[model samples]
Target: MAYISYLDLPKHWGLERGDRVLLTSDIMQLMFTTMRNGERFDRDAFLDAILGVIGEEGTLLIPTFNWDFCHGVAFDYHKTPCKTGALGGFALSRPDFRRTQHPLYSFAVAGKDQQLLCDMQNVSSFGVDSPFGYLEKNHGKNVIIGIHYTDCFTFVHHCEEVCGVDTYRFSKTFTGQYIDAEGQESTRSYSMLVRSYELYEATDLTLIGEKMERAGVAHVIVLNEIPYRIVDLTAAAPVICDDIKNNSSRGICKHKLQ
Candidate 1:
């Protein structure tokens, strides 16, 4: 097998030097193809490939969200593990990664803008002060690997919050034990723009992801049988938001169950 190294990343993903990227992935599937027999996947090498392409001036943000916090579980920023998947957990374990304190939706950051993301204080999960908002502000790309958008296109929800598309979501507050950056414990309340279950039917955001791909801001690549998508959130958000606003028939919100 011809191995793809860290040096091959930029060309494959069309990543620019020093570009900041928010990565959402399930490394397991990719590993199935990329890893050789009887050897554990080297997460460090995968991370290095990404970090190498982004270079010193770039930043990498990985979702470390834990929904249990929304249901009254305490969130210790220093110890609470991300339920997202292997890649997320690996990112969290890195000493350089700093996680934001949002109970339901949090992000772990490394590289140039770690402090900026760690300082986010958005009470609302997708509010302007959240990590999603920060990614947009920095003109970052949202890269999804070995998973479909329906599984984790979180940035879309941020755009919905920004557009005030409240037809299918309601604001709710959760109180939990939170540990701040300084390791101080405090009882805190945070808001989440939760979907109204009665109004939702498990819609697939992959269709919207496909739409973005057609529009040129989203790119898809297949390597060793694993699929990867790279989307410019700054460009894709407006298109998605408008689709939500004007086309109720084809809207992301679903009214029927699958």
Candidate 2:
């Protein structure tokens, strides 16, 4: 009775072509439940679907937020289960491969153990360790198939204005492993920062568009609005729509085009 099985996603997302895509369980649940009222897609099933769509070379980009994984005492730890938030399930479950920390931006990526192809971070006045950073790394390679979301990229914008930090810093902790400076077995942290997300929509899109251009990503698909089939990010074109009758006052139900 999972949402993925219940909803006709293969048809809706135009998966017939078998394109590569990046999706989170949170986004899958939201898209399925909002589009249909049946069983939801479980975590395993959703992951399977993404793998099936992307194939071997196709990459599935996911964000592992530093706030969720960090146990350090410097920041406020929410301690909520990974699946509770928007991208919580994917962020929590994936393996920690690469991490970067700074005063403003901080995040990590689930490693190859979790089957991630590309992972990177950025540091800015705003939190730069973001999904967008992931997008930038693989930009112009047509390396990205899809950028799915449960919640829009809103936190990145909020963190910069509120946190007032310069670099977003992150690290992966070792439980049992140890290493020494003289090429001996030891444990340490790996960190870096690529860029930041300022509070400018146009600037943000411009960067996103340039990355998408490099990656050969022709479409930026979103599930919420239904006015246009596709949008050209570079042109800043508006999605044109036809006027429809509002019959809520009457008993006549109408099916509107999305």
Best by TM-score: 1
Question: With candidate 1 superimposed using the best TM-score fit, by how many Å does residue 184's alpha carbon deviate from the native?
Answer: 2.2
Which lDDT tens digits does candidate 1 get at residues 1-258? Answer: 355543354468878767889889887776665555344567877787788888889999888888888777788877788888778778888787778778778887888988877777788998888888877877889888888888888887888788876657767788888877678889999887787887766667767877888899788887666788988988887778877776651546575332
TM-scores, all models, native as reference = 0.92, 0.39
lDDT of 2 at 179: 28
lDDT of 2: 0.32
In candidate 2 the C-alpha lDDT for residue 202 amounts to 24
**Backbone clash total, candidate 2:** 37
Give the least accurate 10-residue stretch of model 2, judged by summed lDDT: 236-245
Residue pairs in candidate 1 whose N, alpha carbon or C atoms collide under 3 angstroms: none
Please report the candidate that would top lDDT against the real structure: 1
Q: lDDT tens string, model 2, 198-252?
A: 3111212333333333444335543433211222211211110001112210111
Candidate 1, poorest ten consecutive residues by summed lDDT: 249-258
